[model samples]
Target: MSGITENTKTSGEPSKENPSPNSSDTPDDEKKDDRMFECNICLDTAKDAVVSMCGHLFCWPCLHQWLETRPNRQVCPVCKASISKEKVVPLYGRGSTKQEDPREKVPPRPAGQRTEPEPGSAFPGFGFADNGFHMSFGIGAFPFGFFTSTFNFGEARPTPAARGTQQHMEEQFLSKIFLWMAILFVAWLLLA
Candidate 1:
């Protein structure tokens, strides 16, 4: 890629009004080499470069800002292909320093994800036992069992408490509460 100093004036400010004399004078091969690494968004040499699945290149910071601009609609800035933070691949070129950490910037590019291979089928000896001795219980008698336990069906019901006792009054209050609750539930069911 073309170095930043190649386009800068002696004062260090980038030349906007006049094209750099050396830029046109440079060989076409060098220009093509420079363009290959230039970010599609900023149109400059890509720093912290990343490539979209659509094969477009961009600076990580520029691409991140583009994604932030329309979070609901993440697309490639160049090809408009479906793109996301996880899908972009970071470009690590030769001479890039390993000591320089990418996360120093906000919202670092996602690291490449690797998946483990699928496990093979179970072993032959690991199969279920072959004794042919299996025992199973059925719920076909569940309703009868539940009623027998709860209401003691076919047996005598408990006798009621004598009138005016505290236990009798509490039982009466509970019965009234239950009756009102059942009535309200039935009314709700019908209305609904």
Candidate 2:
């Protein structure tokens, strides 16, 4: 049977239309290859594509063509690994689902939609400071800590605390520190 028919027979599930050791079809070859992740750069089903040391899959010729153009400084388009033409395999085989997909672990965020740090539910006045959403940085990457955490006192100029202003000059600096220190000392003694 042709590869087309074999593929159609097992659309969602993987199976051979007719099992035969001598059959020349995709099903028989399927066992040999399990990695079939598509290349993001070139659009093609690379069965024998050379797998870069970075674990990215690419067609041998296509990868070769890419590296050939820039021989001395060859880098895998997906993983940016320094690869040489001689090191690349002439062909690759389909990969298995059991094999890890780098894309999933390093899921590409849409432009600026990356994860940010938002305050947890336990936190009331502290969280990410953004226009919308509760603000949660994805996984471990968080930029915005709180949307209202910013101490902006105006809808216009964010900073109106002119250093030269009389109010600023009169601002109590030492008193605030003394008061807090005394409060801390008392609290500590009480707890002790």
Candidate 3:
């Protein structure tokens, strides 16, 4: 009985001489590992691969289509994390080349954009004349506000174009159209 129990224990436990079938060196394990690099959307190997900020992998074309389907609410398909074309990082495998693809619609993975830092200026206000720029902000009754702004009270406005010139005629025509629009708007407000 003791000898039979000992044999059963030895058979159950895998020995160096008889390797277990579930070892990582098997081809099945390798194929499963290849799946790990597959696109989350397509469930196949990634082409023009990109990785979201949340670390989910996707093929650029698949991800682009997903984003196009919902232009307003862009989020990661796998994790619902906020994502955008600008935010995803492209994964360039060692074998990938810089060759231009022929497909017009399916664009290649996005490349990182680079721009030079803006040159620092000694004086921040160098672009403006000290007294030339004036800005006023106020909230008042609509009619009073409109009159004050339209008449250009207490502000330097450019003089109207020279009388009888093409420019002057154009301005007058534009003003009349606007005056009609304002009157219609006021009428609508009163009626409503």
Candidate 4:
């Protein structure tokens, strides 16, 4: 990656445009290099540069401010591609020195994320092999056993959601529907 200058003029700061360098004086390679690293948002050399997943360059500060200005819709300034602060990849140029303290209010550019590789098992065993002993006690009497198992006697169950919440209302509605269905099933069984 090409080096970006840290002390370069920010978009917010005043700057004078240099007269176009004579084609004969400046090499074609140098001219291309200068324009290549410019931030899409600030239209200047990128400082604390980051590249969007869509491959557009930006100064982290400029991009952060742009995102802040329009919180609802965040997209690439160049391509209008979907973007977010967390998803942008920071560029670390060679010989770039870290500043001791940040002078600007904008937070530091996001770091690259790394994840560990999944472990490989030599032999995949049946899932139940490691669970050890299993035991169950059942009352042989038909009516009592059905009640005990169906009601999950002495087993912990999740408490209902708070009364006024949408989740609670949905649960109550579903419960009533299931209760009616069960009653209809019992009635059908007796008639048949």
lDDT of each: 0.61, 0.47, 0.64, 0.61
Candidate 4: tens digits of C-alpha lDDT, residues 1-192: 111232242222222333232222457656654666788878898888877888778888898889988877998888899998877867655546874322133766447666665434432232223332212234446457635545433333444577789987887787777667767765775798
* Candidate 4 pairs with clashing backbones: none
TM-score of each: 0.43, 0.28, 0.43, 0.41
- Candidate 2, residues 65-168, lDDT tens digits: the string is 68757856788786687875445533312333344332222223125334556544443433234322221122222223322334333222222245667755
lDDT of 3 by residue, 1-192 (tens): 644433432332224432432344778776864666688998998887777888788888899999989977999998899998877767655456763332223766456767665535444333233333322223357678665554433333445677789987887787777767767767886899
- Say which prediction, candidate 2 or candidate 4, comes out ahead on TM-score: 4
Better of 1 and 2 by TM-score: 1
TM-score of 4: 0.41
RMSD of 4: 16.9
Worst 10 residues of 2 by lDDT: 132-141
Runs in model 1 with CA error above 4 Å? 1-26, 99-104, 108-192
Report the Cα RMSD per candidate: 19.4, 16.9, 17.4, 16.9
How accurate locally is residue 77 in candidate 2, as Cα lDDT from 0 to 100? Answer: 88
Candidate 4 Cα misplacement greater than 4 A, ranges: 1-26, 99-105, 108-192
Ranking by lDDT: 3, 1, 4, 2
